[model samples]
Target: MSEAPVPTGLFSGITRLDHVGIACRDLDASIEFYRSTYGFEVAHEEVNEEQGVREAMLRVNGTDDGGATWLQLLEPTRPDSPVAKFLERHGEGVHHLAFGTSDVAASAAEVGGRGVRVLGDGPRPGTAGSSIVFLHPKDCGGVLTELVQSAR
Candidate 1:
């Protein structure tokens, strides 16, 4: 009989909550709401074509030593995209949580073996050159999960 390959530790450790994705019908409107009501400062913003999302990161003052971070907005580019579908059904709310990983490939493989459905077949290039993969919500108790391996 063939031996099962040893599973490796992919995540050096879950570093932190990289970001919390929020599905929104209107990215601009949701951003404004966070700014006006919560005073969150926009740290960065960008558009991802492959995933078809326009997103922004917000810095929440006093959450960290000085300020912590949270993802304020993400709007799907098309109605057919996953984020768009989520908003249509759920009407805007927490979409997913991203965790910083050390080795995305190994983490994905391990999770996949446990019957968790992964979005990408393998690690794909993501924002900021990080290798990333998405775990389908069906296996994760209705929460989309992203494992991101830092480029550095």
Candidate 2:
């Protein structure tokens, strides 16, 4: 029989905050806001149809010194999509925070054991062809959290 997966203790296995996802009513406005307020630089941009949203990655300035980490802006393609719902409810703000982990499935399982609810039972394909999993907001202190395995 295959051995059961082991949980890493309290996300300690995670090394850093990969990115922070923000659901925006207006992608251009949010991008401008981040630029004007924080001077972040755009690193990547793509439209993900499977996720039904368009996204952009903005590298946080001085992140090596503990400044703002990478920021992701998500604009929904449909009004019924999750990002749209989030905007309707929260009014353009941070949606989730992604953590960089070596083994996302193991860390997710560990967090699940602690009564945290993960969106998926296991890792799944995400934007840019990366593996990822989302944790329920209730378990993350009201913040939706995504665990992402590096593309490397």
Candidate 3:
């Protein structure tokens, strides 16, 4: 006789929409365009060596009052980076949708336990001082998804 198992909700741990990840060939150009056209200012910028990407986060509403989403523009630093591969295959567009969470590892584990295909196995370092994980696009209806737990 097998024992009963606990159940977990997928969206329970997620807090809010973190941002949309956009892969582009030129990070500075994309940042400039978003800033000049949409008034979205760069909130944070960094190069994640682990991920091999130069990334910038733009505040969509131009104010970091909390309770807002951002736009993450990613420029690959190496040809093997995920963003670079995405650019080669799809050519500069939305790469992934990230959701904010307090516990990225737990969120990723819960999703994985539910038989969802998760990329990178578990949580790893992300830009903007966060831990993150990506859910495979195929499992997420062709939309690459990410879960982020901020250092803040």
Candidate 4:
């Protein structure tokens, strides 16, 4: 019997679990809760009008290193925003999981070539000036996934 060929190039550039996005009603409250309860510190915060979210990246553990994983809290900027729609359906919880990649465009192309549906036409602007592309939840085992390429 012939052995099946191994698939290549799918997520091969992914380096680490970059962040976990959490959808919330209030950004400040969520940030405060994480600070007081888990002692997490906000590393960055910004409003992404294109994505329709006001988000904060909370550094897990300490800030002494650049490799710490982040918890991204996302609050919708408008009622018609994607985050708001997610909140309406799921009532505030984990939204997506992001993986760090060296090249978002290459990763996206490889994944898309393998029949997995990527969300947009191409990589979009992400937090911290990174480039990002989202994979459909249905194609990603029912969990939304994002590929992030940090700004150089």
Clashes of each: 0, 0, 0, 0
Regions of candidate 3 where Cα sits further than 4 Å from its true position: 1-11, 61-67
Model 4 per-residue lDDT tens digits across residues 4-120? 855533555776678999999999999999999999989899999998999999987432224557999999999999999999998999999998888899988888898889997
CA lDDT, every prediction?
0.76, 0.79, 0.84, 0.88
lDDT of model number 3: 0.84
Error of 1 at 151 (Å): 3.6
Across 13-45, the per-residue lDDT of candidate 2 in tens digits comes to 576688889898778888888889978867778
Selected candidate, larger lDDT, 2 vs 4: 4
Stretches off by above 4 angstroms in model 2 are 1-12, 61-68
Worst 10 residues of 2 by lDDT: 60-69
> Candidate 3, residue 152: CA error in Å?
3.0
**Model 4 accuracy (lDDT, Cα):** 0.88
Which sequence of candidate numbers ranks them by lDDT, best first?
4, 3, 2, 1
Task: Indicate the TM-score of model 4.
Answer: 0.88
Model 1 spans with C-alpha error above 4 angstroms: 1-12, 61-69
Q: Pick the candidate with the highest lDDT.
A: 4
lDDT (Cα, tens digit) per residue for candidate 3, span 38-128? 8888889999999899999887742232546889999999999888998999999898899877788888888888787878757888976
Candidate 1's residue-wise lDDT over 1-152, tens digit each? 79985443333345556668888878888889998997887777888888888888886533222224467488999878888988888888998987766678877877788888888668987665679899988888888899877667
Local lDDT at 93 for model 4: 97
Q: What order do you get sorting by TM-score, best first?
A: 4, 3, 2, 1
